[model samples]
Target: MQNQVRQLLVSLQKQLSVTLQSNRETLCHPVAKGDATEDEWLCLLKNHLPNRYQADRAFVIDSEGKLSEQIDIVIYDRQYTPLLYNQNNQIFVPAESVYAILEVKQELDLDKIQYAGKKISSVRNLKRTSAKIVDVGKSVAPRPVTAILGGILTSDSLWNPPFGESFQKAINSLTLSQRVDLGIALLKGSFDVSYTEKNEVQTKIEVGETALLYFFFNLLWRLQRLGTVPAIDYAEYLKVIDELS
Candidate 1:
């Protein structure tokens, strides 16, 4: 499985290279909003899931159902069904099916962090209550719910000591699967630019632009190596890159 995943990453890299070469104009021309880096991460995860897992097809529901929140990504088994709890009757009804929930954050803000924790808690409570109801009312297989929190950890403090400790504490408080099925990713810009004082004057310097590309490429490669994706198909992989480009 791990080897297959690596193959997929390698295939993706090859496709990326080809796409960049073929679409030199597009690559060179900066978009009005630059690149959709967050969306790219979501897409990569969605596309890499095994065929058995239907990724990004689930919706997010609050405990009260008053506000509808859509998850960033979800994967579901074909047989799974969705259900909603009715406050009036205290009963569960067919609502929607969800395999997993994905949350994406660009920067770790306090509000977003709190929201993430609440989302996980809501999903956990829903699953537990629903399971009890199902066991008592109907004889059916149990439905497992998994929650995934993923984002670009752009904060330097998060990668360091005390801040990282706090962040990890918050994460560890969530109702994660016993198998450690939850996923978390931290992505940062590989290139940095700064100004330095030279002889009482200011000077500007920039890191290599290619560093960002390398970071992404290596990310894909490591994920593949970790068996997060299926075996690579160079032809199909290139096709995806072409479509995205």
Candidate 2:
């Protein structure tokens, strides 16, 4: 079973590499190509990550009525959290349920890296509700707000020697709230951040053609550790919305 899974991931890495290369060949339609790349990533997450997480592209919301920046990929818990603000074809998910958010780019560089950090911070900084309903057996305690994994998915890297000190420096420069938990510079390599006993951030950079597989599994481990998001206090959200109106 383990070997079969490994083979599948290896094959997927190769396919993702080709997808990125094909996106680059387009001459004048950069925006369309970018959108397609993001779509491809969404599909990958939907197919691979544990069934507990639901992946899509949408704006994340919190109980206090704050909305996150439009995210390229949002992995949330549809099983335990209620869906709010669904329209003709749009959906707004609660921040409490989001397990991860990722930005997709054609090429990753220092500038784009900073942009990704900002996007992630917007979601992480929101106010989430953990209020438990009394009807729940013995009044369940509120679950801690699970850490939302932030990442970037790029076809390639712009560093002279990708995944070297330069890339490490970029990862180190980010504040704790803006740190990228895991990522894949597909054609170059994969990177995942770890915390020391003292909570200092450490970047684990892996250079190889099989980066997508590395990125995917590292992400899976992180998600598993998070367990589940806090039970949302829907009544709180309703009360706040009424006050605003």
| Highest-scoring model, lDDT | 2
Tens digits of per-residue lDDT, candidate 1, 7-114, equal: 664566455434433433344544411234334544665675555445442344433333324444444433444334435423332223343444444444444555
Give the range of the ten consecutive residues with the poorest summed lDDT in model 2. Answer: 132-141
* Candidate that would win on TM-score: 2
Regions of candidate 1 where Cα sits further than 4 Å from its true position: 1-38, 61-68, 79-96, 109-111, 127-163, 172-181, 188-245
lDDT of 2 by residue, 37-69 (tens): 998898898887778889988999888879999
Mind sharing the TM-score for model 1?
A: 0.42
How high is each candidate's TM-score? 0.42, 0.92
lDDT of 2 at 91: 83
How well does candidate 2 match the true structure, expressed as C-alpha RMSD? 2.1
